[model samples]
Target chain A: MNMSLKNTLKMAIKSILSNKMRTFLTMLGIIIGVFSVIVMVSMGQGATASVTQSIEGMGSNLLNITLTDRTIRFSNDNLSELSMLEGVHMLSPNINWVAPVKYGLNNEAGTSVVGVNENYMVINGYTMMTGRLINPLDIENRNKVVLLGSEVSESLFGQFNPIGESISLSGIKYTVVGVLEENENTLFGDNNNMVLVPYTTGMRQFRTNSIASITIQGTDAASIDKTQSKIETYLMTLYGTDTYRIFNQEQLLSTLNEITGVLTLLLGGIAGISLLVGGIGIMNIMLVTVSERTREIGVRKAIGARRSNILFQFLIESSVISGIGGIIGIMLGILVNRIISTAFEIPISASMQVILIAFLFSLFIGVFFGMYPANKASKLKPVDALRYE
Target chain B: MILLDKVTKTYIMGEIELTVLKGISIDVREGDFFSIIGPSGSGKSTLMNILGCLDVPTSGEYYLDGQEISTYSENDLAKIRNEKIGFIFQKFNLLPKLDAFENVELPLIYRGIKSKRRKEETEIALDSVGLYDRMHHKPNELSGGQQQRVAIARALVGNPSVLLADEPTGNLDTKSGNEVLDILESLNRKGRTIIVITHDFEVADRSKTEITLRDGIIVNRKVK
Candidate 1:
């Protein structure tokens, strides 16, 4: 004789419903375990995504090179030659000088003043809030002109329009060109805290005729790698190997992803322990339930219940409990991700794949842990069970 | 309809191996109402267990419907109990969660009967015991007499060849006990072969045949 799975499930549900409090307590472990796992993974993915996004926004088709060899120097002729290289769209000498900056009464002893040319506006991700950018004429006439970053503008002008105004840098008055928009804070230093000046003025300020740092914008992603290798070859002849280092967005993105990937797994592993404990909880409760219902098992067996029927009855009960808990955990996890992501603006990655994996794992826990108790119940002797009292 | 040849039963408790039933033999024809009367510890319960197929004999041959059952496995015994023997317990062992109709319908569910046929047979069995209106009531909602009637319905729903009742009225009031005894006699009058295990003369007096057992052996036999 065969018992339908539907009837067995019905009976299991009836038993679970009879003891509402204990069943819910058993299910709590699975819910909390699944919820934490989903949230932790989303957080790790969100961090990785935000990093990649900021780097991509900064333009992936660019090369940043810093010269470490102090013996070699880039003359004006050498700068011209490098700019004329194939696939080089634009180039800006990225020279940083920390010096005293003052606007009438305001004075800061160590403020970062960066040097750039006309193409620097397009090469770096910068947008003007007011006034104009440095022009080629300012570099030719060696005129002192500076663009104020959002933070620099706030410190120098105090809400007053700084465009067309003059600020003293290194004891020299330079006319302010424009104020830049506020930029997002990222791992790669803040662009809002610096002041930009013409490279000619900056070279004069640093008292160095040769440029040390350069930011080159390539034509596109396909040609950037080719341009980098060619530049590296030429730079070796000048600065030598291990003397000059270059950075690319693709390399940085890969490294960031690798770190986040490991972090995500670590979080998942920790969460998995809780899920394992939940399964053990189910097994413990199920064993107790089997022993408690000994007489019931005897009655069913006396009435002709096969071992398979009894096995399914208990197995289905455990699955239903954990399955319902899993659904609640998934919804709660997504809700938590939504709340946290909104509270702190970040792109949290929550994919259906993770949800599916967690759900299936919970169901697996039900079956795996329920096996022992169910088998014990099914194998009970009808005579002994009936006489168990 | 039933046959047993020197059937024996023993239980081992630690180092002491005690024989509950030394040797027993019996034969009952089809449609015969049989009764096994004995005092407590006289092996009547053990004999009933063997007859109900809930257990096996220590040694000897048992035949039911011309099929040798002493060598049957546990699963085979379960099937034989399902298809051939119906047991009515003194405690009215109904699962507390289910209603009267569900309790009566359980055996058919295990028998893998379709829902329509199961419903039909369950209704008929409950109606035969005059508890059709109380089918929806749970065990705790009914009195002792009504609970026993429901148990009878459960025992009859499977349409087994013989009904094996162990102390059918052992835990009932005088009136409730008489009511259960009347139901058992009426079922037997309908040509349902029944065997009742009891120590009470009041229960044995109604049966067509009685076998008095003492210390696991038949001491007297009466055929009326």
Candidate 2:
């Protein structure tokens, strides 16, 4: 360290020590700003991680096609057409219902009903826990056989095994063929509270050909984009642009990630404003310090010290103030982030680039704001300075 | 050695010119213990500032040793001050943040002296002022007399050709003030050319030569 810098650092530390309250107050703005950025970014990153994990759990490389309007009908013919696509590995058309099932009195009343095909279990990676899944023969004969999810089985059968047991849906009796295992990674909603019936049985009972959504599994990761493109082209060519909607799960995930990134930056940018305020605080305090030390400036000048020396002394003082504050703020921010992460089940990470940028920016703030005050102190006429009371 | 020929300095208040030092001339040889005694507003301070290179005369010639310094730029004047002269102030203007050793080492620092050499020279200078033991004490921690001694030590550290003191004991008790004057006399006796500015006749009596000023002009000179 240069001599003047050593002295200036000593003086700056002393100045801060002498006025503890003021120093802390000056540091408060920076602390809050840094703390806000760390917490916001950590929460945002955790939320995005949860989303990605949920997407991966829902069967990898999956696509969803929903036919919402009556005019956008995709019947057996359309399903065959989609199945013909080379990249599409499987196409499972689904029909859904919400039939309230009951076993005992008021305590056992519940509604858990789902209507889907036998292929949905295989394509969506679901397996039967008891009896076999509904076969193509059951759908062709329109037999009233059903499969119950684990929770639905327990709700309607009261602890007994529900396989081969009969349950009433819309006052019509159907025999339960199997129970599905509980899904542990349900993010959107409770996937295990659902029940599935053969597609023909659902259409025969509900009397509607309205399909809820289509699940398509691609042959491989590379073929997903091609499969999606082919589906979009087929749907648009067959039913026009406004008829159906196609959503790629990967695209949805990336868009969500983009939103999280924007949120992190916006939070960080808003937090950056307080650093600017802290810089202004340093400037104001330095101005006061220069005035208070005018006599010292004169004494040094009168005793063979040059103008540059006086300027350097004051500059170092202000720079050290802000620089120390910046370091302390960074440390405090990380500490608070860790505490929050522990409480909220999230990980908080700060890049080395961010630390370096914050440190250098604070240094620049010191030099930029300190220049005016240091120059003012240096330019004072020695005689006038000495004459100051 | 110092020489001044027809030096004039003026201050402008709005439009009217206020001349402080009107056509003054004087000379002093090396190793002289000289005093300039004057009443308030008698221009002694202005002349001291000019001699110390803190101010330039509005008109005149000034030569220190053999070099003309009256027309030097501010930067050049500062360089000359750093290389050839040291100043002691009436208030014993020690920097409050610094201890005695650091204050004394300041002049050498400006001269770009290495820290090891500056420390050695500072120690010797403070020792000469009888303040080596108190070298780590800040100005506020020391007595007025000790602060003035540290100021003198600071002046001596650079080994300058001239030591200029302006009312060096202006803010002390007589006992402390006398102690400072005694130190200044001893420094002069050891061959550091010293000049003191004071209005007190008793303080002026300590010098070997005294010049009295009144209303911007030298009125009398006594060789003691």
Candidate 3:
């Protein structure tokens, strides 16, 4: 607030403004540094958020169990016993096949036909839009009953009622018992373009008794890990080897979060190199400034400027340059983030902590790199400085 | 008042020891208009630097206003330069970036003076140098003599104990040089102590006392 400091600051601004091109060139490094950091971290955050949303959509407290060994197979009796294990709330065996489906004169190829048990609708959080879902009797009697997903019904029957209609798959005609509601949380395009059939009927039709995968739900969130270990142990006993992989949603999510977190940090580190380079650029320009203004330093010294005064003037000048660069870089970074979000249609989360850190780090870079040149300016003797040509 | 007792200055350039000033002694009292005349490398500049507190004596004592400043630190010397000595250089030394008014206010800014007082003093100094109307012109925009006048105003704005001018009119034509000399004469008439260092006899003739130097020693001293 003192006049000396104020005047020094004014001098600094005037000098920096006088050399506009050089100042801007010096700031380019920091601008690029901050921009890349924000964009990369934001993209990482977007990826994490999308993966989390998709995982949560599958249902919380859900576990997927897959058998890697083709030789080992699960019988109905074995699956029922596995369902009775501790912490197990529900379990559904699934088998997937691609087939051409026809209803009326309309036909669709590569229509995903999923074979699931009666509990599949409940365990996978599928909602019934019309008619009724597959009941236990449908699974027990190996009935040729089917549920149509919203997209499948739309493709085959258009606006007409799909329930009580017959859809033929692989020359087998099955009555559509119900249609599933559209799942908005589906990540891989549309999950609605599918048909669900009773596991028994699908096994008979597809001539494959081997189940592809099983989805299980724990009693609650806290019991998922315990349920996962129990299922692993039960499978190990049945197959005499650990060939099955049990993926719990919570564990998988945390691992995903860890990977993305490291990725974000790595991105920030790479961007930090440019910031360091930017600091060096400032130092280089400041040294040139000090030398170029050598006579000015001498004149100031002769006019009674203390060593500290000269030091502070140059220090303030460099800090102002980097501070302004930091602000501009932040704005550019946010702009880049906006561009990416709009272009990709992915919502990016911007954390305030990251922005604050980037700004402060830039300022620190100014002070840190500005020290040498300012010190050199301050240490010049009045007589020698005045004599400097 | 300024006094030197057997002051000597030696500079070590690599292995060569060059003594620019060797056992020189002189005295100038308050209200005295003095000039130091010498040829190139005669240590006149060395004496000026010591008198202005820009450099210290190597093996002798220096007194400024009864204070022994020979042993003063760089910081203390800076304060003495700020508070006690005003320097007017041959090149004018006005910062190119600052206009006349800001350049004149620079010494007072270093003194931590309030803006109101600084403005008042700067105006008086510029008016004294007859550059009040041209206070907003930068150094490059002004003629050489006008720039020197601005430098003189900067030197006097802080009201230092003495004005030490090194070739104040060295770069100007005869008319502009005489104009600067007239200003120094009038300022001396107002009881401001002035010291002019030059090789020009015409410039030295205006001072009441003159010291002639040759080979780092004062060979002649004259009083009007």
Give DockQ for candidates 1 onward, in order: 0.64, 0.36, 0.46
Off by over 4 Å in 3: A1-4, A59-124, A133-176, A182-248, A348-351
The candidate, 1 or 2, that scores higher on lDDT is 1
Q: Of the candidates shown, which would achieve the greatest TM-score relative to the real structure?
A: 1
In the range B176-218, model 1's lDDT, one tens digit per residue, is 9999999999999989999999999999999999999999999
Q: Please, what are the lDDT tens digits per residue for candidate 2 over residues A29-147?
A: 55555555555655566677777777767766678888755666777888878888988888776666777654443122445455566578877778778888888888888889888
iRMSD (Å), candidate 3: 2.6
TM-score of each predicted structure versus truth:
0.81, 0.75, 0.77
- Cα DockQ of the candidate 2 complex: 0.36
Q: What do the candidate models score in CA lDDT, each in turn?
A: 0.89, 0.80, 0.89
* A327: Cα error in model 2, Å: 4.8
Displacement of residue A116 (Cα, Å) in model 1 is 3.5
Q: Rank the candidates by TM-score, best first.
A: 1, 3, 2
RMSD in Å for all candidates:
4.6, 5.3, 5.5
lDDT of 2 by residue, B46-127 (tens): 9999999999999999999899998897668877888788888888888787789988888787677777888899999999
Please list, in the order the candidates appear, how each scores on TM-score for chain B only.
0.98, 0.98, 0.99
- How big is the positional error of residue B134 in model 1, measured in Å on the Cα after superposition? 1.4
lDDT for model 2: 0.80
Which portions of model 1 miss their true places by more than 4 Å? A24-108, A117-119, A135-145, A154-176, A197-246, A250-288, A325-372, B27-30, B65-74, B173-179, B205-210, B219-224
